[model samples]
Structure formats: C-alpha cells, structure tokens
Target chain A: MVDGSARISQDPEPRKNNRVHPVLKLLYKKRWAYYFIAPATILFCIFTVIPVIRSFILAFQEFRLMGNVWVGLENFKYVLTDPVFHRAMRNTAFYTVVMVPQGVLKALILASILRNLPEAVQTFFRGAYYLPGVASAVVISMVWKWIYDPNFGLFNFILGTFGFGPYPWLTSPKTSLTSIMLMGILTAPGYYIILYLAAMKKIPRELYEVADIDGATPFAKWWNVTLPLLKPTTLYITITSIIGSFQIFTSAYVMTQGGPGYSTMTVVYLIYNTAFRDFEFGLASAQAIVLAAIIVFISVYNFRVFSTDVQY
Target chain B: MRRACWVLVLVLLIGSLAVSFGSIGAASKWTGTIQVWDFPRPAAAEEWELQAFKEFEELHPGVKIEYTKLTWAGGNEKLDVSVAAGQPPDICGSGLRLPYILQGALEPIDDFLTAEDLKDFHEETLNAVKLNGKYWAWPWYNTLYVMYLNADLFNERGVPLPENGEWTWDEFLSAMQKLTFDRDGDGKIDVYGFGFTFQPTYLQPFGFIYAEGGRVLDIDKNEFILDSPEAVVGIQRLCDMVWKHKCALPGAGGLTTTDVNNAFLNTRSIAAFVDTTGIISSFEAHNEKVEKGEIEGEKINLVTAQYPRGKNGQPIAAGPGVGSWAVFKQKDDAKREVVMELAKFITRGEGQKEVVPLIGVFPSCKSAGNVWAGNKNLEHIVPAVEYAVYPPMHPNWNKIDEKIMRELQLAVLNEKTIDAALKEAKRQIERLLEY
Candidate 1:
C-alpha cells in the first residue's frame, strides 16, 4: 500500500506538491461523492435493514393478548409442517414456473416486432401495450372479475358465438389458477416490453445493416443481434418477474380468495391469513422468512445463468 | 452555498420542533374531533350512518366525528396496519371474529363498565364480547343462519310448509324433488329446487353435530371431539344433501353470496337457504315478483323457519355472529372516560331505538328486542333471534372454521369421501386445539 502511494507521489508533473496531508486531500477530493450518497444510505438503513432485523427477532417470539414470549424455533417448526403452508408453497411454485417463461417470451416477441415499426406508430403501440402495467392492480382485478363472470361475462359471450358452452372461469378449482396465470401473463409483459425495446434501441444500427448485407433474414437478425444485445435486460426482467409472481396476493385475494378450494392459495396469502386472520404472527413471520429465502435463491440462480460472459 | 446550507438546516430544525410540540398539543385536548373507521355497506346503511353522526353531533354539542370507510374485503388488514402504526381509530366497526383482541392489539373495556352497566345488556350478547373474563367490546348487532322458503313453490307442489322446523332426511329430499321443475319443457331444468352456499358462514348447519349429541371440543379437556360417531354422521348428512340426494343445485359449493342471492331474486330457484339478512331486502323490494299475477296462475309467498332437526329431534341454530364496539384503554384518564361515554351512548336503549329502524341490525340489549318487534318492518327477524345461539368463544374458532369448511367443500365436490374428509378435518382441528 505504501509503495503504491509513493509511486503516485512521484509523478513527473509534481501535481501532489500542494497537498497538506494525504488523508485530508483524499477527504476533500471525495466530498461531493459522499454528499451524493448520504440520502440513500440513510434511507436504506432506516427502512430496509432495520425492518429486516426486527422481523427476524419477531419470528422467535409468541405474540398474544397478554404479551410476547421468547419461544426459540417453535414457530419455525409449526409453519414448516402446517398443511396450509405446504399448499401455499406448491401454489406459489406453480405460479412462478408458469409466469416467468411465458412473460419473458411474449415480451421478447413484442419488443422485436415493435423494433420494425415507424417511430410514431411504435410509440403509440408501446403505450397501448404498457397501459395495463400502469393501471392499478385493484382496478384491473375488479374489471377482470366481471369479465370472468359465468353468466354475463364478455368471455362467455365470445365463446357463445362459436356455440361453446359456458365456462366457469373463476368458479372451478381446475381452471381458477390457470385463469389467473393467464391474466398475469397478459398484464405483466408490458413493462418488460418497454425494457427490451429500450435495450434494442441502444444497439448500433451498423450491426443490423451488416447482417442485412450479409443476407441475414429478420429471424436471423433477431436471433443473433437483437437477443444477444438484450441479454442484460432479459436477465433483469426474468429475476423481477419470478419475484413478482411469487408475491402474488392481490389477484387471489380479490378474485378467487385462495379458493375454489385453496387452488390459488399462494405463499404470501397464507402469510397474511396466518398473521391477520388467525393472529398467528410468529408463524406468519417464519413463513415469510422462508418465502424471502426462496425468492432470493431463485433470483441468484437466474442472475448466474444469464450473467455469464455477457457484455452490452 | 453556505447561506443555502444554513437555510436547509433551519427548515429541518423547525420541522422537528413543530413535530415535537404538535404531539404534546394533541395530547392536551379532547379537541372535539374523533376518528371512526367503518366498512361500506348497502346504501340504506350508509344513509343511516350519516344520520347517526348528525344526531350524535347535536346531542353532544362540541364533539366532531370524522368517518373513514374501508372495503369489507380488506378492512381487517387496514386495521392491522393502523394498529401497527400506533394510530388506530377512536371508533371502529369490526366483525365478531375481532382479530385485534387475539393478536394483542385491543384494550380491554372491563374497568370502563360498571356492574349496573353490565346488568342492562343481554347476557348472551355480553358473553359474545367477553374473553378470559374481561369484556373487550360492547355488542352492536347479531346475525344467525335461518332457512328461507318460497311458500308459493310449496303450495304449487302440494308440499307441506315444513312444520315444527323438523324434517327427516327422506322427507327433505322428497320435498326438494317435487319443487324442481323444467317449466318450458327444455332439456335444461330452469328452476332448481334448493339453493345453498358452501362457504364458511353456511357451515353453521354443522352445529347439528352438537344438537345430535356430539361435541366439537371437550371444553374442559381441550380435546377435539369431531371424530365422534355422532359428529361424523351429522357432517355426512350435510354432504349427502349435495352428493347423495342431488337435491341442491350443482356447483353449489363454489357459489358466492352474490350467486345465491341472484338465484333467489330472479326466481331461478324455488327454496333458498340463506341468512336472515340475505332475504330481507329482496322480500321488501320485489314483493310483486312473487305476487299471483306476475307468474300466471302461480302465487308466491315468503316464509322462514329454523333448520331441520337431525335424528335427535332437537333443532339447533349454529351460534349467532355478533359485532361490537371496544373502548381502548387510553393513556389519559379523561379521554378514556369520554370514549367509554361514547360507547355507552351508542349502545343505550335510546341509541338502539334511534338506529334499529333504519339499519335493521338486531339490538344487543334484551329489552331492545321489543324495539325491534315494534317496527312492523323488522318483525320477521324476531323469530330468528329467538333461536339465536352464540358460537363457542375460542380464539381458534376462525382456523377451525376454515378447516371444516374446506373439508365440507371437498366432500360436496366428490373429491373425497365424507368419512375421509371428516377424519382429516378432525385431525386438523385437534392440532389447532393443542395450540
């Protein structure tokens, strides 16, 4: 460390001669950097770090009408073996698996298609597709609820035109989860399309022009140039989509209510039920920690797979 | 730059000082302002709430009330968040479950009520809000499950009107079969005989387990008694209504409150199974729909009766659900006294009389029942109240209800045998009781 500092001091121009003390000089040079970082650092510690530590401590304590009691890992043991917890895990896993690939593929295709359109038309289409992402989940879920109505829904009306019998979209245990997943896939691809489109726009036109001169078709250009350039955005979207899908509560809470008999009872919904509905906060917190761990593991795995040997 | 920095520091210091003093100022006054949290109900109830507030301000000259409405579906979570933030409302409406008390978010009101105060309220209503020998709330209203019938359908089919509130399994099945009809001769049966919901609220009939000489829990021992032979038989009979008898409409377990209510209102179903609150408005609003001329050569009437008796011959209504107001143990003695006074004023006979007619909510005071009966519009609810039973006061009641309701649904859906489902549910409830 001393040799590195001495070599910097031995520069030909003698630029360091006016420095009173090395430590003071270092502080003065990076003062603006410290100022720029202060707000986010304070906020992150107060909100994110503090709550996580507090929730961990709360997981071991039994909260009841009288007071809290320290009860070691009893809460963890109970949550792991609880039937509702098991069902929630299964449902959340199914949703994550279904939503991630479906969301990414559709967003990719839309982004590639939007790339070829004129700028004005492209902006209009992008905004149109992105509208669902901007709309509140509560509003969208309520509207979709009416659309899934068995007797009077637009879906059944359309099916009737083809002479199909009425389908109970949100009522049947068999179809409820798939019906919700279809809605998620449709509504969530908008933001990912915007991300991928932005990344596609940043790629130099020269690469695509060379591909065209070299007799590359549209499919080949998308496969070789567009997809490779969009790798970083794809990784970001994949991780976020998996995390978002695992935390799905609003749809199930509003529409199916974890039912047609627990078919849509996701992990976060069970945590909510255990904590608020049943007042089992200790168990709820333990389940939440497990859920958070699962999300982190899955996200890390996705990042490793998509981040290997990739550059913009 | 130095001047701007001084200005930023000055602003933040002043903000902190204001915050510190503002809380102290708030702590010193009754301020005549109270915050209330309530869920939106039907338009009539909303109107009644506004009127009640208007009357309250006139009676208590300086008090000002602000009301915030929450959605029924998310009210509990909203209340939880408020409590966690330590800013719970001065007054709130809650369901009988009252999750806050169980979770340690509520303050007991025992010290606020005197012995004389306790004597005036009905024992059953008081018992509903009491936990561990301390009263947590003032009981507001009550609801129970009752069987509503389409009397005109009974007359057309020549079936008896379910006398004595008792029917054997075969008799109930035969009556439903007679009520089913395909009026237009289409392949489809346009009108179902009986419509029932499979939600947790409807599982009240499972209370027949007790009526049939069975126990849900050995109260003294805290052991689950759901696997007892009598209890199994009672549950099996409920599932048999859907699976074995085919008396109820298909997909009945999946039907929601809206679905069943619409079926009855549209006259698509003859005999409807619903709570007393469910049919009151329909019977009042569309009396003409069931009138003689509306259905050429057919007449319709509305009647309600207790649920049918099991083999034991005793008809039991599952416990009535109750709602109540709880006074928080305020840190300030004067504020606490005022809150207690507010609770007493809302629950007194005069208050009950003022609100009962507009809201149709049952009175918690026994004498208030007379007020209920005197209203010609509310007279029908009296008989239902006569048979009301409060559910067991266990903190785990909601969890147990969820498990049993799921088992009942599985049996109704034919996904599992009745015995198997009952056995699993029994095991689950036993585990919960241990906790």
Candidate 2:
C-alpha cells in the first residue's frame, strides 16, 4: 500500500506554465486504462453488483409487486426452521465432505501421470479429459443419465454381461446423493489439473535431484519433493472444489431432479425451487445470503488451514 | 353591444357540446399497440395461432397487436417476472388460479364477460376458470389424461383387452404380468407392461391415484389429504408392479414424459402408459410417417382406455383444466376493454377452430363444437373428458404437485414405503401451505 500522494504520480515537479490541473493531469495519465475498463466495470455493476445488492435488500423483505413489505429476519427464520432446508444443507455438506478430497486427488493424479508423458501424448490426453468440460453441464448430465439407467444404461449393460446384478445408480434414494457426488468427482476437473501441472513445472529440479542422490525411489522423491511443493496449488483446488460441490445443481436437476426423496437435493437446487417453483423470492434471497455467508466462512477456514510460506 | 354578446354565447354553447361528445368518443375509441404474448410452445404457436391477432386488427382498424413468443420451459416465470417489473403482456394464458391471479396481476373474466358469453363454454371449463366466485381467465381448451395401450403388443402377448376399456386393479395387474415377457431366451425381461413419468404438474400418472378414491386437497384447498389409506393403496399398486410383479420399467419414477412416450411408440419396449390426448395425436402422426416409409418403427395400434379402477368402482382421471387466455391489469380502462375483447376473440369459436388443428387440443367452447368430427384420433378420446376430475385451485399447488410426485417416485423406486412416501409428501405440502 502506497500513501495517497505517492499513488498520484512519481514525478514531484511539473513543467513550468503547465495549464492542466494536478487532478486532470493524473486523470489524463490513466485515460486509456479508464477507457479500457469502463465497459466491463459498468456491465459488472449493472448485471452482477446491482442484482447482488438488490437481492441482499430483498432478503429482508416480503417481495411483492405493489409494495415490498419489510419483514426483517422473517425469511431467515423460516429457512432455519424448514425441514427441507435442513435436508438440503445436509446433502450439500456431505457432497462437499466427500467430493472436495476426491476431486483434488483426481486432478493431482491425472496431472502427475500426464506430467511424465511425452509432450504430444500429454497434450492429446489433456484435450481428451477437457473435452467433456467443453460441453454444457446440462448436456453432460443427459449423457450421464443414459449411462446410469438401470434397464438400458452402458454401466448396467457392462455389469449384466458379466452376470452381476443390476443396481439402480440414480433412482434409489440410498445411492442418489453418492451418484451425484461421483459425477462431480469423475467429470474431469481439467481446470484444476492444468493448474497443478503448471505448478509442478515451477518446482525446483534441485530438490528432486537431491532426493534421488539420497537413494530415494521415484515415488519417494515425488512424495518428498513434488507433493510438498504443490501445497499452494492443492489449496487452490480444494477450496474451489468445495465451493463447486456445494453449488452442484445441473446434474442433480437433469438427472434425479432432487429426488428419489430429498437424497440428491443441494442447497443451491433447493434455493432455486423455493424461489422459482414456489414463488417465494424473499425466502430464496434469504437462503442465498445464508449460503454466501457459509461460503465466506468456509473459505476463511480453508485459508487458515491451508496457507503456506514456501517461496522457493 | 347586444349583438356581440349573442354571438359569444352561441360560440360558448357549441364549444361545451363539442367537449362532451369528445369525452364520450375518447372513452369508446381504443387504439395503440396491445402487447400480446403467444402460447409458450412454439409447435403450439403455428401459423393459425395468429388468427385472433389478424381478426382483432381487422375489426378494430389502426389498433396494433404486438405479439411476443414464449417457450413453455420458463414462460410462466417470465410472465411473473414481467408482472413484478410492471410490464406484463396485455394478454397471456397464465392459467385460472395461478400466481398471476393470486397476486392480482390479471383481471377477472367475469368483469368483461357477460353471462351470455359464458354460456358458449362447457361447465367443466368454467369450473376450472372460477376462483373465489370470480372467473380468472377465458376458457380456451380442455384436456383429459387417459391410459393408452399398445394394442399390437397386447395381441402379441395374447393378453385379453379390458372389457370396455374398464378393469379392476387385479384384472389390470394380471393382464400386465402376461404382457411383460422376455422375447429372447435370455433371463432378462425384454418388455415391461407399464411406464409413467413423475414431473411437476405432469398429472397423467395421478389417474391411478384417483382410482383409489384418493384426493389431493379438500374443497377449501387448504390441506394435504394424499396420505389417506386409499391413496397409500393406490401408490402401492404402482410400486408392486415395479418390484413384486416386475411388470413395469425399472427407475420409472425418474423417466421423462418423452422417455415413456418414445417407449410406448417408437422403441416399443413398454406395453402401456398413461398420457395426455397429445400422445394419441402423436401416435397418429407417427403412423402416417410409417405408412409413407418416412421412418421405421413398430406398428402402433393405439388403444385409449380409462385409468384402471381400484377400490373405487368407477374409473377416475385428472383433467378439466381450461387452458385459458387472460388479460393483465391495465390502467387505461379503454385499453383493458380492448385487451379483454382480444382475449375473447382469441379463445372463441373461430379462434379455437383455427388453432385446435395445429395444437390438437379439444376446444372448451361449445361454439367450437366438435372440431374433431373428421379427426378420428381425437374424436373418440373426447368422451373420456367427461370422466375428468379438475385439479384443485390453489397458488401453492405446483409445489404441492412436485412434493407428491417426488414421493410417488420414491415409493415406486422402493426407496420408501408407500405410507411413508405419501406421509412425507403430506408433510412437505403442509409446510408449503403453512402461511
């Protein structure tokens, strides 16, 4: 943080008889930067910032077209007491508890395997894994629905050929939540894999060479050198994966539709149903605010747990 | 001076009379663009859908109707959002007792329509439109969900058809067991006897529930009664078909309407299912294609039947929903009147005649009387509309429908007991109606 005066300009003196005001000079210096940022800034404020602010206000009111009545804490109280909301919270928490670790591990393993491959092979594999991510979540969910179908799905077909019994992957309430989380864990977290691979490249070769000279095997070297160095990247992936798992919706919506009971319901999906399906916008806003608060608290806790000081 | 005063008095008298006539003219004359939204489904909004707009423009010259199209997926939500933003279309089909009516976003049809005008529509449609002793929308069309059987499949399995398309639960189950058989020597079953979807407001499957004399809401529309013993028996029968009998498709509760429809028609795996009149229309359309060698599929000998009866002697099904046009509340009295006229013109005989062929729905108005005289597919299905039970009128009914349908799915999946499922649904619905 620079002081206010230092931020204006590094130059202390102006040209003799310069007509421009100090403020105008400062503004003119950053004119192109302002011009470049204005469109994005304005649009961000209009679409994202304004809606978020309005939703926050809406969280405190009974939303009505004619007149929105101030009913402070009422919607929050309703959400707290609602059994469905409690179920959704439990589902979301369970999904995160299971999904976050598996997602990070999947990405880490894939990235590690790809890191040692030939450049051409690695590129092809990366693209292959990322291909599914390129398609919309709705489309992927539809494909997964076919794959999980008990009667005619690919998974059941394979199992049937071996004379193993068919199990309902998404239909039964017992497996619906697990099925949803498995989708998240299996959907190729390509973005995180790329991040890990990039971070792995930055790890110093000297550390691995030292481990090798100390009679360490490849796996031991990886554990001592590669693993410890990727802490920052792992933390990034973990926090993001946790957030994504909590917000899992499209797969659940397109597949089980939060059903076979409330087994597959997530907080975000429930919020959507409460607002759009039930037309309880105030309650929905309140639920969303609560979710945001939860995310912030979790993110802070994650930072405290995962922060690292390894600079090399 | 006297001549000058007389001249001024004559001018003043003429001016006052002119002003009074002008006010009357302004009150009667309506102009400007009436923002109209089309039916949500694009397929439903064929060329003939614009007939009402053209007619309105022809009758009231200089008045423009700005038409907008909405998709079925989020159309109602769009209308609700528009209303909240104070820019709802002048006319739309927001249903009779939905949020638009509950929130006072639409005008009551009774205000603009006379008793004589109401006479053209069937009493069933009118019943659907009436909410709180006031009609909320113009009755446009009627729908009756019926159980459709693949008669060819029945014949192949040597299963006897129900007597007069009416059968008790035992008879239906026995027939279903015969129809469900493995074609190949493989141990796995090849064809299932039944399939149905459990989507929100998808009421076709609920026909079976009503057969057990199970009702969702009371007359006052305030409580959930779906957890009754009869209702439990009703849902249990469907569940038994899946697990105990194994005569139904696995994971049927998660199947879509399209999935079941395709299985009944194209895939030809499932022998039977319950669906709206549109399925019969679709069957006819597909058979036409098959005849022309346009597509290849199994022969479709569509058989329409009442939902199988349970403890209740008579068959019961859900229907009697009047898909109706409604006018949004307008500040200008003249504009509102014109909008009402447009709504009426769009829903009456000529408009019904023009769109029914494209949409394949039975018209609610008697004046559009028997548009299905030559259309054999829909003609036979019309009589079943009499056996229809209207869905309960309530604002939270959509959410309640979802809760009940989810419970139905859970029961069918054998994830929960039928009693537990319906009770959970009841608990959820009671929570929705807590206010």
Candidate 3:
C-alpha cells in the first residue's frame, strides 16, 4: 500500500502540470484513511444525506406514486398560513425553550452528586439511571399515559389522597402541552448525565485543592471551578438537547394525540400527519425544512450565548 | 472423430431449444407472493383470518401470502407510508378512504364483482365502496355505531332500558340524570350514567350530531354544512350532557375509546357509551374473562341501543360505517386477478358466513342473512345498520375530521360555544374543501 501510494503522491509532475485535481491528489495521498471510513461514509450518504437532499427537493413538488408535479413555493405557502402548522411551531418552540434548560440542570445536578460517590455505588446508580434510555420511547409514553389519566391515574390518586382535585394532566387544552413538557423534564437524564460525568472527570483535581486552601465552601468550589470548566460540554449537550426537544413525537402521538385542542401538537408530529396520515407529502416536506431552519437558528443562538474556548 | 463430436453436440442443443420453445407455447398461470397487512381481528376470527390465505395458497401452488400484523393505532400511518413508497400490500383490509383512491393506488373491483354478487350487497355497503360510481373494494362487513349500555348498571340504578332500544333526547337525558349518583355518598360522583368520546378520527359523536336533522356534508354539492342550526343543536345536546347535565364522565371531550371502554370494564363506573360493532368482540372477550373468574365483577350485561332521537325523530348511527377490502394496484394483471380472488374468497360466498359472525359484525351481503339472528346482544343494533351514516366521502377527510373534532372538543369542554365552534369549523373546512 505504501509503495503504490508513495509512488503516486511523490510524483508531483502531474500535480504541478495541473493534470490531477488537488482534492483527488490529497485523497490519493491519504488513500488508506479513506478506505477505512469508506463503507460507513457511503452508507451515511445513502441513508441520511441523500434522503435529506431528496426531502428538500420534495418540498417544492406535489408527491405522487406515479410522478411528482413541480409546485414551486405553494407547499411552503400553505404550511406557513395553516393555523395548525402555526400551533405546531409555537408548541415546538415552547418545548425547546422550557425543556432544554431543565434537562441541562437535571443532568448537572445528577453528575455532580454521583461523581462524589464511591466508584462501586456510582457505577450502580449510573446503570440504573441509564436503563430508561435503553427502553423504547413508545413503551415509555404508554406508561406515562396511564400515569396522566384523569380519573384512574396515579397522579390523580395521589392528589385524591391529599384531598386535592384531580387534574386533567393530558386531557385539558391548558395542561396538555405542559404535561408533555413535564414528561421531558421528569424522565431520567441519562444521556446528558453521562456526558457531564465524562467532562467532570477531566477537570484537574488541583483546582479544587486551591479553592479549598482559599477557604471556599463546596458550593463555591463547584460554581467557580467545575461549572465554568464544563462550559464546552454544557454547550454541546444543550445544542443536542434542544434538537431532541424540537423533534418530540412518539410521546405526543401516543399520549394526548395532540388533542383537547391542537395544544400538544409539535412540528415533527404535524409533519408526520401531513405526510403519512393526509398524504400531503410535499407540504410535510416543506414543514420539515422549516423545522430544520428553526432548529438551526436556535442552535446558532445557543452557541453565541454559551460556547466557550479554554486552553485546557 | 471431430465431425462425429460436432454432430453429437448439435443434436443435444436442438433438443434443449425444442423443449424450451414447447413450454413457452402454452399459456402459463401466474404465481408468486401476495402481500397482506391486516389488524388483529378478534382472536375468535384468527382462524378465519388465516383461512383464506391458506386456501389460496393451496388452490394455486407456488402462490404464497406474506402477512404482516398491524395494530389499529399505528396501522393508518403504516398503510399511508407504504402507499407513498409505492409498496402497499396486494391485499389489505383498510376502508375505502378517498386518499388511496386519489393516489390511484387501489384497483377497483367492479370487473371482478359480478352483477349476481352485486345484488346481495346492501346499497349503503355498495355506496361505501364506491366513489365516482366505481366500486373500489369488496365489502366484508358493515358496523353500526350504536350505544352500548351496561344492563347491570341500568338495573342497579332502576332505570328502565330504552324501550325497544329507542329513546328521545329528553328520555335519554332523564335516564342519565337518574343513573348518575355518588354511590358511597362521597362528595365526588362515583359513576357516570353516560360517556362519549369526542375525539376526531372517531365517528362516535357523529351519530348524535346527525341524530337530529343535521347532515355533516352534502356530498353532491361538496359543502361543509355543520354550521347549520340543526347540527349546532345536536352537538349542543351532547355538550350539555358533559357540562350542563353532568351525566357523562370527566374528560369526555378528549378521552379515547379505549379510555372510556376501560372505565366501563374495570371501574364499573360507566353505564353507557357509543362504539361500532367491532367492539362487540372486545365486550365478548371481557365477558369470557369474567366468567372464567380471571376478572373481578359480574359479566357486564352488554345491550346495544341506538343513539337517542333528536328532532329527526328516528335513532341514528354513524361512523366509518363499513369495513371493506381493497387490492392495491399491481404490476401484473394475472397477479391482480389472483389478489381479487383472495379478496372474494375472504368476503363473499362461504367467507362472509364464516368470518362475519365469528367477529360479531353484521354482514355486507344480504345472502349472509342475519347470521346473528337470535343473539340478544345484537338484537337492536343489527337492525340499526339501516340508519347508519358515514362521513362525507372527502379526500381530505382526516384533516376535515381533525378540524371538526377540535371545534367540537372545545365546545364540549366549554372553551367555546357550540355555535362558535361549528362556525369556525365550517369556515376552516370550506377553505380546505376549496383546496
């Protein structure tokens, strides 16, 4: 492999004469590296990248089995003007605004507590918290649906015991979207916790020692030393978490069905119904592009506010 | 020696070519895979569900049916995606919704459904299968959306059964009031007399909406007419049961069929609810469990009743009124014929007689003729099919349904007045219909 590649790369006459493309020459020089990742890259292109490109194209075409008709901006115009789509956008924005912070905070609290525990205890607790992420979201939603049931649910039963009124957790328009948001905050913050844990372990132990010598309390030490150092990781988790929040579907689809009104309908659920339920694939694709653009805008805003650079 | 070898090779080659041409000369029967996606019917009908697949395979060697099990909750999306992917099953038991028709994905069965076979089908059943006067599916069974009353609850409350399973709006309201009580004298009401789901995608509320002289749409003119006063009063009457009369369960406006049914079965707190004949199988199963002592309770004495009369003066039933089978478009005519044959083998002749009764639904074919002739549970609703109605055959039915139900839900929850909700729904639907 080295003999063949070295011969090609070392021969600079073709490159100097502009016979070989610069990108191709560079790829040829790194042929072994390319070969190692080629399979995965090909698969990713086929499954993810191509479909995304096609979805963008589909946004401007009326989809049909036999053939698709070009509809220009009609699909985008319809989705923007539709009241239901507006509701979905508002609901998605709410999820992003509310759940993302709660999620980051919960993970921070969890990782901070667990890192101080004995290794054995830490391992056990981490595994326990991570168990839910391994389970199907659809299955989790079904369990939550029962917990939120108005008359016979666990929440109502608990309230009844306290001589409080039964709340329509998922059934009322006022509370339905909040119930869905509450689920996001309440579920085990396994993924984020793991990320925070790994980031926390890399902080120099001497930073804490210096803080202790300065007579700083544990809270002050954490606030001054741990959190600022974890900013890069926090920024990463926050961006990803916001993306996840915007795409909330399985739970809403299973629990309230975006109902009582269009209260709980999120952008992804609307896209799904438009494409699959109503067969308006072009409109669904347009809605999806709008959702992607919103996520991109928010992600950029998050970076401007949270991203940090540290030599360490 | 070389000449002899060449002659021998030529003789063998000619023999092979002659045999190949001989086989190609005869008309060959087509055989391959016939794909099917179906929801779980009653476990009682499991045998019937697989029976046609088995018989079709046996009758035509090399023909195999690949079956995929689908859940009722998720099946619509699955079917839609499959159709959009141009990979729908050759045989599926989805209703003749207009979306598939407009996609030109379904193969109309008119050519295969003969005139003799046509005579046996109910006109309503035929109409349900037809759009633009072309029949698109083979009707297997028709289900009526009627009220199911727990007779035990009725008796314990000393409320008489609807006389002849018929009640006017006043009588219905009075019975609901009498039956609802705080059983343990707790501050909270223990059981509701009547409960109805107002979710979109379900036609449970439609029976009442159309109970009076209200029709959802005039299909001939293609208009959204629910804002008409007749429909408003009909919807208002239901809203009153939840808000004014307080005879229905809490969360009735947004609850699911499963929610209300579970409340009735497990809590024993719901006396009456509305559903299609498909639910009869579920009730029968629950009864079986009760008899076996696996469940704790008296066997729910399920009695079928019609929705109370509105100003229309006759009981009304409405829903996705009929369940039928359609063959999706196929690449080969011979395979299409085979798929149509399988559809016929499942719905008509002996097929309807065997499958329809096991599932406890009324047959679409008149010749299948009262399979539940003496069953007390079906005594009233079996005849109520005559009054059954369905949604207008709109291509945008799902969206239209969503809007209408959202408005109705707001009305039922007292978030909006019935008139306002209907007017808003009509205003939105007119624009959608224009599209």
Q: Best candidate, DockQ-wise?
A: 2
In terms of TM-score, the best-performing candidate is: 2
Every model's TM-score on chain B: 0.74, 0.80, 0.81
My TM-score estimates for the predictions, one after another, are 0.73, 0.86, 0.83
Candidate 2, after superposition: displacement of residue A102 in Å? Answer: 1.5
Off by over 4 Å in 3: A1-30, A117-128, A308-312, B1-95, B105-121, B293-298, B311-313, B325-355, B365-368
lDDT for each residue of candidate 1 in A134-224, tens digit (9 for 90 to 100): 8889889878877776655689778867888578787677888898887886674778889998999899999999999999998998899
Which residue pairs in candidate 1 have backbone atoms (N, alpha carbon, C) closer than 3 angstroms, thus clashing?
B319-B389, B320-B389
DockQ of model 2, rounded to 2 decimals: 0.42
DockQ of prediction 3: 0.31
Candidate 2 docks at the CAPRI level of acceptable
| lDDT tens digits by residue: candidate 2, B1-435 | 999999999999999999999877765778899998855543555555666578789888768988888777877767767888988888876434366676788898787777777787777577777766788888777777777888888999898877667787888899889988888979888789998767667777777777777777774567788777776676778778888998988877767676677677766889889877765656778889899899886558977667777674765657736688888888998888888888888787877876766666777776776777765455555554545667777667777787888878877777678878777787777766754
Task: Report residue A109 deviation for candidate 2 (angstroms).
Answer: 2.6
Q: How far is candidate 3 from the true structure (C-alpha RMSD, Å)?
A: 9.9
What ranking emerges by lDDT with the best candidate at the front? 3, 2, 1
Candidate 3 has which clashing residue pairs, if any?
none
Stretch of 10 with least lDDT, candidate 3 chain B: B22-31
